[model samples]
Target: MGCPLVSIIVPVYNAERFLNETLNSIKSQTYNNLEVLVINDSSSDNSVEIIEKFVKSDFRFRYFYNTTNQGVSHSTNVGLSQCKGEYITFHDHDDVMLPSKISSCVEILENNTELDGVITIAEYISEDGSPLGTKTALPDYITNNPFFVRAFERSYIPTWAMFMRRDIINKLEFDDNIKIGNQDADFFLRLLYRRPQLYYLSNPQNRFRQVSKSLSKKSTSTCEIYKKHNDVDIAKLYTQAGYSKVVIDYALAKANLWRENIESALNYIISAHERISEFDEEEKDNVYFIYATCLYLNQLFEPCLEILQKIEGKSFRAETLNNQGVCWAIFGDLTKARDYFESALSILPEYIDPKNNLFALNASESMPVRHFTKFPLRSVYKTI
Candidate 1:
């Protein structure tokens, strides 16, 4: 019945610039019962000195150092092994939590006995801590049981925005083998499989610092690394949980398509289409859109048009029409492309891509149709 202790595990690696601000945010939390575990991952900078300062000032602050530079996963696992709180959470060294973050999450979990974890919205901030924007860990449509599918589609859940019961934390381990990225998604998928009742807190109480040199900001090669290392393991995990392989294939296909790996995307798309019965109408249309876009990208204009025709729903009509316009533009049929773009604009009058395509077609001499042809269709699809 007393205020349960919360363990905040932060992994630091040469984060000397932001370490003071980050620790100060935690130290100023509204909730008093907290054990701050700052895992020093062989930081060569004055990160250790800063952490030692905090330890000297605060009785609740704990610091542990790794012998060598292991990654975030390993450092976090070390913190996990050492934490002795009833509830557990994670903090990134560069990010800062609002004062109310701990109190809000702790109150929710304590009151809702059925909930295993709670997630809050993240406000993205620049290096100087200026506000960029806000993002939710899960979309409006995703809740509780559908978290696995949503996490597979996109790993939007920020680690710093989550608070979990210690038992739930004990049930999962961060996969150290996932070196490149998306280790959180892999761990979260496994956790969701256990059917833990999860809750979403929409308040923007977590400030996520978006640094240009972060791993996610790296080149497309990092994405390829994630696909190679973690995608297969995630797919296998979903399969073992009795979910259809088609779902996994669909998500993988989208990821490959996003990475512009046309051939791999096509393979997964084909596999998903072969088991089309596994998806509902809306999901099927989404798959159709991806399939059609792939065909159009490969310059298979006629077949791409054929696949787009099979899309039955109104949900993706504007996107379908815009892609149809792109296909026509690439095939050098400017007049037909203009028509499709106009039709798409009729559906969604402010649709940017189609509007731009229409402008390009009409002003052909100023902006040659060939220019649109060379433009990557994947970029256009991303806007939708």
Candidate 2:
């Protein structure tokens, strides 16, 4: 039998810089039966001409342009409306799909009758097309967890990395209301609510281009997504899935912290503490660190120090010590703060934060020592 047709949706908006490379990557796909839908969201640049070049050359490539500059979600919805294929996936105009991406994802869906979708890990690329590094997702862990649970952890799966049955569009569509960012998160969360059995391949099938204007820079939208889902219904869903309420609350706290809403972050972390038993040792340490950081940021130094004293794990030992030092300095004890900073340095001599703090401490005997609270605790949790 011939290969089943696969529809790839390309949403373009002033992406002339990367349009040729993106379309070329799609054209080179190993899977021949493809319907490439290029939706131009009113590009003021030469993106339309670049898109037209492909449309004129290839019968499989179809181009559509929006009159007004609709958002990515709207352009994607328009592509979804027109695509007719056995499998479909979204491709950002600025990103490049590996030549075998379509073939690889289709092979999995073709073989796994029980799976409704396939998502692969993605390799991150710089704006100049050089390899920056991979994302924070550990393939073994992320694949084991439910997509719904993993959605709250961190964004690893880009739109181009996911391939699904065409029928999913029949049931779900992009939320055009997500104006700023987190469009993929909101859409995937809604998709996970229907409980689609998805397969996550360890091998990366796309290169996600990271530019200055990428949506990941928008922290306010991330805060909005977390707040929008902090209700009892979302919490209950996680609990039913065997994840604890603490998970949701901690995520909200982290989200609020990103946007520098210290009071809200502190409140959410405090709420997370109410069911802290649900977390394992590592997760507990993460929560404790965030709790302390929130308190420290909110001027509740006493309780923050108390929380810091309770952390017994080596996971955040350096960060905890540095924060404790800052608290001491704020309390008018420069000597004690210096000792704590030295302790952190002894534990991690190469650590940047504590080194900076220690240097600042030695420079002055004044209060308010330089504090460093960069905690990369997002991917630390194992699938629970």
Q: Which digits, one per residue and each the tens of the lDDT, describe model 2 over residues 1-384?
A: 348999999888889889899999999998899999999988899998999899999999999999998788888898888999889999988888888888888877787777778877679999999998876554632243354465654443456767999766575877777644677877776665556677867677889898898744663265565555544655565666666556878876776786567888889999999889988888788788889888878778899899999999886677788888888888888788878888988887777776777777677765246565735433442455
**Local error of candidate 2 at residue 361 (angstroms):** 9.9
- Scored by Cα lDDT, where does model 1 land? 0.74
Q: What shift in Å separates residue 11 of candidate 2 from its native position after superposition?
A: 1.1
Q: Determine the backbone clash count of candidate 1.
A: 0
Q: Count the backbone clashes (under 3 Å) in each candidate.
A: 0, 0
Per-model TM-score on C-alpha atoms: 0.71, 0.80
Q: Which ten-residue region of model 2 has the weakest summed lDDT?
A: 139-148
- CA shift of 207, model 2, Å: 1.2
